[model samples]
Target: MAKAYRKDEFEFFQNQVGKIDQRVKSYLEVAGFEKWTWVYAPVNRGRMMTSNLAECINGKLKQARELLIIEFLEEVSASSTHIYSIYDEGKKYIVCLDRSPFSCGRFQLDEITCERAITVLKNKHVVDMKPYCSEYYYPEILRKTYDQSMFPMPYKKEWIVPQEVIDEVVLPPKYKRQPGRPKKNRHKK
Candidate 1:
């Protein structure tokens, strides 16, 4: 019902749900049709349903999540018009050069071509990887980023400060450490 794009389609699903449980149908009705049904939603959610991105990312990070930060970053950080099937040690993988996502998930996460994508590109005789790499890695962008001149700071004694500003008192924040082992990983936003 939430994915139903048309009123009739939504109604069909609603009817089916009603047949299964009248209480659920009543609850859905009380919750407002527009809130849960796509056909009546005022805002366009594109093709992505709620939690779709989160679920997809969670699925992708399943293996990488156990890795160290450096390895995780490396893993997180594809292809052509056709899909390619790749096999490694009896394990089969899929790669598509034209699509943004590969089955490995590295290409999508890092915005860079993964090894599988690279193999496909090599097979296609695509030598230049600049097109596949993120623009942040571009030489022009790098040069532009560091083109501005930087000046060295003067000694503390040579710095000028207002009398009123110097008199201001700033105290450290109060913190109580919680019992248990401290976390090694940085806190995420």
Candidate 2:
């Protein structure tokens, strides 16, 4: 029901859900169709139709999560023709290689070529995706960021502290730990 892009499609799924469980259907209705159903949504959600964005991202990062930080960074360092059509997971996506804003919304939002754009770029035999990325990620820009020399701090006794700052007392936060094994996974938002 959430994936349906047309009223008829949405209605069909809605009926199916109603048949399975009227209570679920009523709950969905009470929550508002616009909140969950694509057809009723007032704004474009792009290709992100999943119920939870964090879950979707977590799924995509499942493999990378096990890798070391440097290895993960290396993997992350790894877009497109004028336009192309892509089909994945029973959904069709339009990727615009020549400009900003692909159907997935990632290209425009992150200022980086998304997987769809990258596929289009590969099909078009285009190399060097650096041009598709934002200037912030450029080698020159990154180099400029740390061009200045960074010095280490002197001894604590050499520091000039403000009277108010020196007198201020900092306390640890009061937290009651739950009685159970600590969770290895991050808390979902």
Candidate 3:
């Protein structure tokens, strides 16, 4: 489970962790780990706790700014003595999930375009895009969702697609009109 940080948590942790937050967030951004679909899953070790430990180091350094080199060296040696013990004792794993730094919310797609996107996405093993219409989003699912007569694809296999599908599949949501019953003409004798 992820920990929800209220104002106090963010403030307190940020202050205590100092430069750690900025550094970590910057690193994550550079690594392209800035999407909602991007998850930081380490089987062990909480990064937050690591930041907190680094914070402790920063705190000691803050206090010893005037200390002699010999004294600082001794403190550094002492600090590193049991770093592994601190690491091994953590009871919970910390995983961070970043959602949507790579948004594609307002994108559109058509039948042929969507199939091509799906094929490309399947080829890429994954994709992070939003289909503007439900029809274009899930062609197969939309088929099941609506009557086949209402929404039919022209091509059965190898969805025909040009380079620009998003532009091609742009349509309004309202197409249903109560099936619009056909009228019969009455002739008078």
Candidate 4:
């Protein structure tokens, strides 16, 4: 395989999907089941197709992408705290599930998704992981949590300015500067 083609992610995925299909066929035939049918459609009739071999391949790809290979060591460098956290709690966070912990009831889950990463990176095989990798899917709450954590400043949702602020603050800014204190007007009797 040429390096150029390897650099194109979709091309890489297509190739990977092919390779896995072949492996599954071989493994099944070798086990004396020349033909066996399993579920390819993802759960809930969504596009989230699943096949054991296919999932394995996708997972490997994600782990490789996570490697963050850099031109220099510093290129891959991140805060020590984060790196340590991944070294420590990441394993559990990535622990394998009977089925992918992240797969959901929605239409988006696929054979290759980040939620299923433990299956690929857990074993540290990237080629095997490719099919399973997409930015790990998150539950809505987790997605919100992740958004909050990653954003240094939370996005301030657009809102109606308080009427008090608009009427009192911004609208009253045309104060004319008086040269001296206001002179008391003398009433002529």
Ranked by TM-score, the better of candidates 2 and 3 is 2
Please, what are the lDDT tens digits per residue for candidate 2 over residues 143-172? 999999999999999999999998999999
- lDDT of all predictions, in order shown? 0.68, 0.68, 0.39, 0.39
Clashes of each: 5, 0, 5, 18
For residue 175, what is the lDDT in candidate 3? 70
For 4-108, candidate 4 gives per-residue lDDT tens digits of 111143345436755879785455447542122222221233344332433533453444555545632343232211111123333323222323433221113
Q: Please give, for residues 12-89, the per-residue lDDT of candidate 1 as tens digits.
A: 999999999999999999999878765677654432223223444555567888999888877666111356678866
Judged by TM-score relative to the true structure, which candidate is superior, 1 or 3?
Answer: 1
TM-score result, candidate 2: 0.48
Candidate 3: where are CA atoms >4 Å away? Answer: 1-35, 38-56, 85-189
Write down the TM-score of every candidate: 0.41, 0.48, 0.20, 0.17
CA lDDT of 87 in candidate 4?
A: 32
The whole-model C-alpha lDDT of candidate 4 against the native structure comes to 0.39
Once fitted onto the true fold, the runs of candidate 4 whose alpha carbons sit more than 4 angstroms away are 1-94, 103-108, 115-125, 130-189
Winner on lDDT (1 vs 4): 1
